[model samples]
Target: MLKKTDCCQGVVNRKDKDGNTALHRAAAKNYPQMLKLLLACKADKNVTNQAGLTALDVARGQVNNRESINILGVCSFAGVSTLYKLWQLIVKILTEASTEIFQDMDGISSDDRNALLVILGLLLTATYQAILSPPGGVWQGAVFIVAFFLTLGLLKPFPRGFKTALQVLLAFFAICFQASIYPIIPFYFYVPLVINIFIFLVFVIMMSMCTASRVSKISVMVLGCWLLVGVIYQSFASFGS
Candidate 1:
């Protein structure tokens, strides 16, 4: 048992009389699930048995053990290959964009940097004015400001595990923002604002999953669909009113 402090230290890679580790046994027997679990627990796949066979070597000797082979490290998410690859590609593109957006001035010429800064400053001023005089209502303007804050937070660089802190900060902001909306805005306005906040929360979670080791692509896709529906419904409600 990994939870037992006395044994967990070397238990995962503990070898038997033949010098075969749990990883070797799982691979030789073609137990994909067991192999995946052992790997996830940090099993040493390169550990060789008395016969000089690694887990991968043993897996190769077996018949039709592609799943086990993949579990050993070939395609990381063999079960969800297509969607996983798509998401990985999307993350790569976004990571490159983040690099450009957050890059230091050392790589850019002075004039180029100044020009970019001016453009951003102008956009910020225009955005502020739009929020101040939003067509929908003051509630919509408040939601816009919160959304902008969340977007900037997501784009900025943070150290490992800092995203969780950002999520907490955003949750606190959302709660305070919602509380402030109750008295001044009508019930109809409050509904769309709540939907917008929910959408923002979902967006943050989806982005967080891009860097997380453990992910649920199906759940993320479903949340994306739900947010789309919410946005559509809010649009209709706004136009009909």
Candidate 2:
């Protein structure tokens, strides 16, 4: 849609039979980078679909990511088997971390901070190198899982501004790391990158929403700044090259 027509006009004119624009679809599909891009192109945020659903409505549906997964008639492994496996592992990590966050002190007494720190350290190293090196998606996936745990570690009882600081660090590094990977990944796979990055944004936002700390809010803003700058700079640099 963005390719055939100017982004602004396409978003303006393209609506479902139900009167939803690309923005509606993007939000429904949990595509924040797409949402940001559409908004940048002046998409009408106020526009309601035929069902009277706003972008926020669609985003809200994604709040419970694992819960809303439709197992019925959903072929889990017929296609993209490796990615499906990866998805399962990612979900497991997210779910476990989420559970740990709410668990009691006595329950968390079993939580190994050293193990967590080691995993987080390893993930940062692994993800940074994985993109620049040969195909090591397994390692990359491990990094993602460890990072999810790291986020959980920061979430519970966050002090004045720790959660926010961690998110900014994660978002900044993730953006930079992914930007580097973009050049290596075939342009055809750009959609996956877009979709996952959108999910990343959603995860970051969720972390912000769940936390009462002010730093989390600040972190979101700073991460947004980095994403915006990264996108613009990447586009210009890539185009010039």
Candidate 3:
């Protein structure tokens, strides 16, 4: 139909009165294959409809349809912008970490659970402090402290999954704390690297000592191996540079 129509009237890029191309309609309806076909045929993804929305914007607004969003996220012409892509990558990493942490938390003793929480709390405090006072100046730390206390109060009554999700989020923040300062204090690059190494060791040791399921142990070991490989790669890169 597209070939016939294009050969007859060149309607491939033609728009209705609303200025929407076939690409826009396919993206709005979440027809990923159709969108791909249209794109291959040189359909304009950047063209806006009457509402001033491109195909990418239309896909983004379909929050309930993640398939459409993911499809558009990888499209060359309609891909997510740089900042949005970074945000998506962060969310994906944290989500995978949260799943692992949730699995590891199961079957652990109350004491061990409390210990992990304390470590996370301390890490959170350190990260939050780093954020407020990167290297040179000091700002008000009361907000994070108060927020931590409030979180504790709220977490006490929540289910295990929710608590684990919060912990994973805190861990992510703690890990990213050094990255936030790496640009400002490039000379002190090793500070955050050492902190991250310490945090990794603590996590591994805690996981090993805990009474988690066999699957959890395997998951932790897999994560440890992945991190070890990353560390080795970075070490080699640093040395070679």
RMSD of each: 11.8, 17.2, 17.6
Q: Model 3 reaches what TM-score against the true structure?
A: 0.30
What is the C-alpha lDDT profile of model 2 across 35-95, one tens digit per residue? 6677656665555577765555555567653322331113322334345447546645654
TM values, all candidates: 0.37, 0.42, 0.30
- The candidate, 2 or 3, that scores higher on lDDT is 2
- Cα lDDT computed for each candidate against the true fold: 0.57, 0.54, 0.53
Write candidate 1's Cα lDDT for 43-161 as tens digits: 76766688877788789899999998887765333335346447657766755654454345335565665565455445544544444353524435444444444343342233334
User: Model 1: residues >4 Å from true position, as ranges?
Assistant: 1-34, 38-61, 64-80, 105-163, 171-232, 239-241
Write the number of the candidate with greater TM-score, choosing between 2 and 3: 2
Clash numbers, per candidate: 0, 0, 0
TM-score of model 2 (CA atoms): 0.42
